[model samples]
Target: MTFKNTLEFAQKLDAEDKLARYREEFIFPQHNGENVIYFTGNSLGLQPKSAKRYVDEIMTDWANLAVEGHFYAEKPWWDYHDRFAQKLAKVVGAKPAEVTVMNTLTVNLHLLMASFYRPKGKRYKIICEEKAFPSDQYMISSQVRFHGYKPEDAIVEIKKREGEHNLRTEDILNKIEKVGSECALVLIGGVNYYTGQVLAMEEITKAGHKVGAFVGWDLAHAAGNIALKLHDWQVDFAAWCSYKYMNSGPGNASGCFINEKYHNLKDIPRFEGWWGHKKDERFLMKPEFKPEAGANAWQISNPPVLAMAPYLASLELFAEVGMPALIEKRNTIVAYLEFILQEIDKEVPGTFEIITPSRQEERGTQLSVFLHGQGKALFDYLMNHGVITDWREPNVIRLAPAPFYCSFEDMYNFGQILKKGIQDKS
Candidate 1:
């Protein structure tokens, strides 16, 4: 699609969009009873209208069946976690057996790390991007320390070149080559939280594996925002929270993916619980922990049906639109946003810079805008005026036009608001 300069062009794009009707499926927030142009899906996605009904189903099951709801409920809460796996797998490009809906993001990360980050004698270091989400940094540091290794010695942080905001794929490959022998695991965010830089997962995974390192990704920002091929990319494991692009409510149930290649590996130690036991003999109360094959083996406890309700509801929507089609639409909308933001920058030179990569393949739905002067104040003003966006520390304001609900008009309106906000301040 060519660059469009006016709101009419955006509206025409929206008018022609096949996924256009999906927007009304969500419940947009109101400021003074008016629906504001919401661009914060990078932080918290809008609630699905069907979510209430989904939660109510669980509530009804609990009211009637109580403990027996596990086996007898309408949806059979006993295997409820498995219900959404196949569809969720489609979104992340993993085999159905390789994906499991389970605990929250950070907890799942710790669990996957336990299995993958086995630091033996000479191979003890872990590699990750430097500006990773703080939770990931803390998890890696704590895990390294727990293994009686100094974080400084055991953690290798790959950073972008000075004066640049995104990591280069070549630099990442070089680092992996240089440290592959000592690296126990290569863990990275599939898409960076701050810069919105989508890493070259296929190349990174191959490089990491060439060094005999386990490759894992934190897909918190990438799962629903971009098309992932975890199995094809040969990523050993991955985990993601559903609250963002997945549009589940805050603190929603999270998911993890384990490649089928590990399904038969009996020696990979896991933190086991009864819920992970094979279904046929799960009720036998057997002393031996015979884990279910694939990612389900990582389950530590029975999932909260209430917590998973929203995710199931959201997945149904994803199933309807299909990820490939949604991604095609997302590429167009994101490009539209970038084009408009660039035009705004041209008019007000030196006032703002887009830190996200301009290339479509290097990003998802987000654009990280770096305000030059009065960053926080400008962000505050935008927010006060009902332009909802998320502000990161230092100077970045992140805006995501989620493909499911965000319209092209939203991007056009945001550009206008941003220009006016900056000009008024100037």
Candidate 2:
């Protein structure tokens, strides 16, 4: 897997790639009248060409069937969300009954916490990574506040050992133990947005359970980017947005996974809606709220068919290729990217320092490079040159080489652009 910083080498890899054809399936943004290197898939995935049809199918059904679309349309608006259950379940490595599409990621996170984050007796603290995605921090903080616990006392933030950019798995597990009887939940982003470090979910889940804490993951970065086995990992609950690596349209419908162990537990309280009512008797609405089986019980409203259509489009691609193939292809291209960047650094000794973990297993598709000598102006310069990337405050440029549309040549070309950017700034 030796990588050369040459267009021919990149083109050769693209030619040999099994997943290369998927690039054509997406419509990339143009800069200078040519396709731009869209490394922002970790933020908003490229639009799938088929998204329109899936969305139009729903619109057509509504036009033709009107009220009857609820029961008689192609996908049947009544159970439109069900169509994605099997397809999405495959992507996240969960049983069909364990996965369900519902509100957006943060909303679902709030819903799941209502059930899983119940603080009682001595167990009142929630353990999560320091610098969690802001929404999660706000959600956890609010949840604790609602329960009459101050965030400072109830939310335990696990910090990186001083001087380290990334968190050590052992430190995280040790933090869970330190809280012991006080910890009620261990909620962490499966892949950190800042460092792109893929936390050891299985081991973390085990550690959380050992201390009798409810465990969950915010999979916004992990879903579709990494291989997840939420079921096998004994993940108590999890949630993710579809817009990122899922390649669904921006701010689309999101999904959640509730372990089968808690599927029918009446003791668990959830923010329920009529859609989550028993399907057979939903029309015969009783004052009593009879819960549906599995993760669907967590759903709060009738799904927005239009919003879910694009996600269905992405899920179709995922179901076709599956994770094993996607992971293999992703690791290869990521390796190529690492080689290119290190070579650039070899030329310009302090161009950037990749804060993302070096090991393939510890990261997903993203490489969070902490710009050393350069700053946002250099990042802006790259953008002006059509090298699209995400810039985080302080000093990090996040580039995710998406498997959906980004080619190996994009990575190589980015290397050249970055090198020149550094030189020009100098």
Candidate 3:
């Protein structure tokens, strides 16, 4: 499909977009009395207007029902989290019994590691990508240290080829094979936060399992942006925050997946709490711990209703639109954005370099660009002019045209602004 940078063409595309009406559901930041061309959903998603209603309902229940809210409220506080099991399972491609909502992303990963990262004898090393998100690096290193092994010795990193910015699937598989019996766990980000590279999760999971290792993913960037098959792929466990493309508010509760195969294991190591005890017998308050049926067994405490309210609000929209429609719009909008960038680059040759892979399947909504002969000034200019984007180290700007809230006109408008910024800087 051909794309044009003209305003009229953009308007036509927007008029044809089925998801265009959904844009109004989001509250965009204002710039000069107009909505900003938001490109930072990969960082923090715009808040859904319905979020307030959801929160108000929770507050109302707390005020009216008081202590009885646990069982008497509209959405009973006791089983509040149960609402998310089916919804979240659909979002991440897992069975209802295999997924649950819980603590923040890092916290859930740590708890999951306790169950899956048991290193015995020669099978102690863990494999992960080089330059993973800082939180994951810290979590993996801390886990390694807690297990009485040095990170340098127990962690194997799959490095990108010298000049490449992305990891090849073959390279990842080769590392898994090379480590073989020594590998105990394979944990990686489903999408590289910086480059927006979508890893081959299914292949990686298979490779890790072949080497006798438990495999998992941190789906921080991948969850709502791309299609995933965690259950079909047999991933041991995975976790994702709801604030990114899912459009939940900042620092919201996380959703997790644990394969059904692990649900029946009685001896799995975990840091259990009262919330994870068998639901039927939870009120009995017995001395011995009996785990819940599925992924809910990993919960360390009761759900934070306030934090989860926004997430539930966002999931409603996701259910209405579904991932299929979202992916269709995502592919086109991102391609259009890429086209606009290419047009701007042609006008100011050598001024921009898109480091993200050109293949649609290899990336999601983000396009991380290397700004040549530009620095923070360009980023600052874009920000001031209402082109909300993300900036990383070494002169790179990440533009994520989130399909649910971003329209084709945003791509065209952003191109004009970008071209002017380049000329002004020159």
Record all residue pairs in model 3 with backbone atoms less than 3 Å apart, i.e. clashing: none
lDDT of 1 by residue, 263-306 (tens): 88888877899889998898999999898877898898988889
Instruction: List where candidate 3 sits over 4 angstroms from the true fold.
Output: none
lDDT per residue as tens, model 3, 30-104: 999999999999989999999999999989999999989999999998888999888788889999999899899
Cα lDDT listed for each candidate:
0.91, 0.92, 0.93
- Off-target runs (Cα >4 Å) in candidate 1 are none
The alpha-carbon lDDT assigned to residue 20 of candidate 2 equals 95
- TM-score per candidate, chains pooled: 0.98, 0.99, 0.99
* Residues forming the 10-long window of minimal summed lDDT in candidate 1: 28-37
State the lDDT of candidate 2 residue by residue for 50-105, as single tens digits. Answer: 99999899889889989899999878888988888898888888999999998899
What lDDT does candidate 1 reach at residue 324? 92
Superposed Cα deviation of residue 143, candidate 3 (Å): 0.4
